[model samples]
Target: MIEASLPALNRRRFLWGAGAGAVTAAALLPGAARADGHAETVGAVMDGMVRDHNFQGVVALGRGGRIRTARAVGMAQIAQGIPMRTDTPLGIASISKRLTAVAVMRLVEQGALSLDARITTWLPDYRADVGARLTLRRLLSNSSGAPNPFRAAVAAEPALLQPPWIDTGEAVRRFATGDLVFEPGARFDYVLSNWILVLAIIETVTGQPYREAMRALVLDPLRMRHTTPVAPSEAMSYRTVSPPVEWINPRPPFLAAAGGYYSTAADLLRFAHGVYDTDFLSPTSRTALTTVEVASDSYALGGRMRTVAIGGAEVRAAWETGNTNGYRSVLGHRLDGRGAVVILNNNAISQRTMDAFAEALLRADAGVA
Candidate 1:
């Protein structure tokens, strides 16, 4: 979910200072919190963010294969003042990119696509020089150096900042005229156009709209019923800045596979269950999906990955964030299957706050001090 700001806040990261560091290990670890009362500590932290920061929405913490804390702290909902729930659907900004990325890699694992193949193999009419140098791997890793049309447009025509989500194919074709910033794979360039081309590839290979293909490949298989292109009943959108009120009902279909999807915390967890399960992806596929690329965003095939020092151990984790319009969201999981946290906030919460939430949960699993 690309936020209203096109260029700024380009990648996903948890703000480390602030309240994030205040989370006591006792409040998060299994003994004090998880055993005696799981929701109390984490839920209190959520409340603090709502009280202090602009955190409005719900969070669901899962461990031992079940949801431990499904809590909502604040709300400025426009939906008849309905409260936030675990099922409340909200925009997950660029987090949607991972969904598209996983879908493409799934096809690759199925032998229906090739990661090393030039993007033009599927998009023959694409500008030859540009396409020749662009591979699915580079595109997925955001190192393809594709020109960033969204950023350029945001700079030239501020009015286009909230431009409608047009057809993915059209966006891919139009952006094809753009020049590459560097030779493919030469640097870590996180460009949104890379996924535009990936969307086009999904259509070319699957002969289906990227939307439908995503449903079949990722959502349906995982039974992510709440994850949809259409917004849910209480599904709210917003922007807390100038000339802006509290709520919005944005329909950004043109964002397509890039950042156009509604998802609930539970549904996102179900997605995690699927993506992390070997049955959902082969061993080799999971490695490719989670292996960090050399430079860009610590991005793997679709989302980003990093190792966090928790307690006394290094834990591998996969995480993604969405910040389009007023909604801010985050989802993360440990590779060792310790824990996962999903937050879908309709009100714009700071990335640091969400980071704090996830950090507390992950640290709890490892008995952090």
Candidate 2:
């Protein structure tokens, strides 16, 4: 059975910085834990959130392969009164971007793809003028000029916003013919449509569906058995606003490659570690996959990488926050195998509170008082 309780833990190390790109390298370091206590100090804070009903999923922290703290609180299905278990699968939301990026990077390593190549190389029939100028690098970095379709689609065809009618190819075919917000690679402008094209590229090159490809390239090796494209009926996503009721989510196959997977906090912790592992990627490929292409952008392949201050020293870390409908989640991992924080909430809890809980764990692990 899934664990639903937080356990006491003893932390011995902490991470201080994220790897490459706009992040300063000097910030990466590992420090010994403080003598004040074990890493379980954040347990009380989490319990408070549960008591107040501010959260309804899982929170976990660990180093290497060992978990220091793990807890599940609130209802997975409030209507059914089914309590959320630590292993309960919850929508991971946009964190899927990181996974998609990794899948693309794996292809790049196999010589089947290239980062600097233009979209036309893969989707020769793309036929769009912008497609000629947009490169994989730009798409990976969110610097592509593609317009974000999430908001506009909701307005134009709110009813059609469901994933069935809006798969990746459909989204790409719609947006590729549309207009560009600015010149490709002009600067950072987040656009959901970029990844649709990415998913399209993946399919065109590999000739396999997103699910099959993702399983072979990422899920299998990482041992993330429970993470998969969400089926609205199998999961209950809550709304953060007034009514506070279960909200059904749609998973367009194409967008699923970007933000449609449902995963457990435990599985996400495994993914956090997967991003830093070179076992599946060569040294050169791993560097390309994780390094930032711009000096001002924190976005690496899919998530952001940056430096944080701790006890007057810098530490590098890679992290991402994802939300959809009523679910919000955060995964923060240090590169040196020193620390990581994974939290998933189902009630639209404040992201800051989650960050605080995670940072407290990092600090406690680092002996930073």
Residues 290-337 of candidate 2 have per-residue lDDT tens digits of 687655767777777756565677777777778777778888887766
Local accuracy of candidate 1 as per-residue lDDT tens digits, 1-369: 212322232231222111211223333344543554444444445545544665557666775435555655434354355555555678887788888888987898889899998877988889998888889888888888898877666578654435565566567765644788888878786667887788888989999887789989999988888788776666566565223356654544545677878887767877776788547888887888888885446878778887777877888888887777777888888778877888777756677777776776666544453
| Number of colliding residue pairs in model 2 | 11
For model 1, the stretches where C-alpha displacement exceeds 4 angstroms are: 1-34, 154-166, 241-244, 247-254, 365-369
| Runs in model 2 lying further than 4 Å from the true structure | 1-36, 48-53, 163-167, 232-234, 240-243, 294-297
Model 1 deviation from native, Cα RMSD in Å = 8.1
RMSD of each: 8.1, 8.2
Residue 104 lDDT (model 2): 88
